[model samples]
Target: MIRAASRRGIRCVFVQGEDVMEQLKELIRYEPGINLEPVPCRCSECNGELRKVEEGEEAILQDKSYVPMAKIGKCDFWVCKTCGRVYWQGSHWRNMRLQLQRLTKSYH
Candidate 1:
């Protein structure tokens, strides 16, 4: 399949693994410049650009239910410009950053 894609002038990085981290590592091995570090720059749902929800701009979210009231003043919030999906750095973000840090150490 990779050969077929290459014949059509396509670039590909083959990765196969059950573990998500392993697969990501494999991808990074082939594409060294790819940034695996977690950053709230794009929407996970639609790949839309994310803009930080500035102070006094939380009302633009439209759906208030998605906003975590407790984390409002605790962390920065971002909203997808296209899909309006809200994002915040919670526990998962820390875990992902840790994994990426480990992956980065292996490269160094």
Candidate 2:
């Protein structure tokens, strides 16, 4: 048998998106510091690792105007090494964080 990701230098992992979301809420269901830390680094759009790209590195930004750079902090830039999507934390990110916080708190 063959797998698409096993062709050469590729790798694969299985994730039940909803499953983890549920688990995070379940595992830290009533933890107080749940909101003190930032979310894990992964492509929100594709769940890929967000690699740090130095200046002059090439990347295809899906939307040039919406590079949400200030939502997280300074040096707010990363690229999804798998899908080539660029990201910067901004307003939408704050909203998502708040929602996740609510989820973690509501478990009590």
Give the alpha carbon lDDT tens digit for every residue of 25-94 in model 2: 6546345354434644788788889876666553344245555433333555677878867776566668
The lDDT of each candidate is 0.84, 0.60
Give the clashing residue pairs of candidate 2, or none.
68-88
Model 1 residue runs over 4 Å out of place are 1-20, 30-36
Off by over 4 Å in 2: 1-23, 30-36, 55-75, 103-108
Q: Over all chains combined, what TM-score does candidate 2 have?
A: 0.47
lDDT of 1 by residue, 1-108 (tens): 789879999898888977879888888888877877677897989988999999888676545786777788778889899988899899989998998888888886
Question: How close to the true structure is residue 79 of candidate 2, measured as C-alpha lDDT?
Answer: 79
Q: Could you give me the TM-score of model 1 versus the true structure?
A: 0.68
Candidate 2 displacement at residue 5 in angstroms: 17
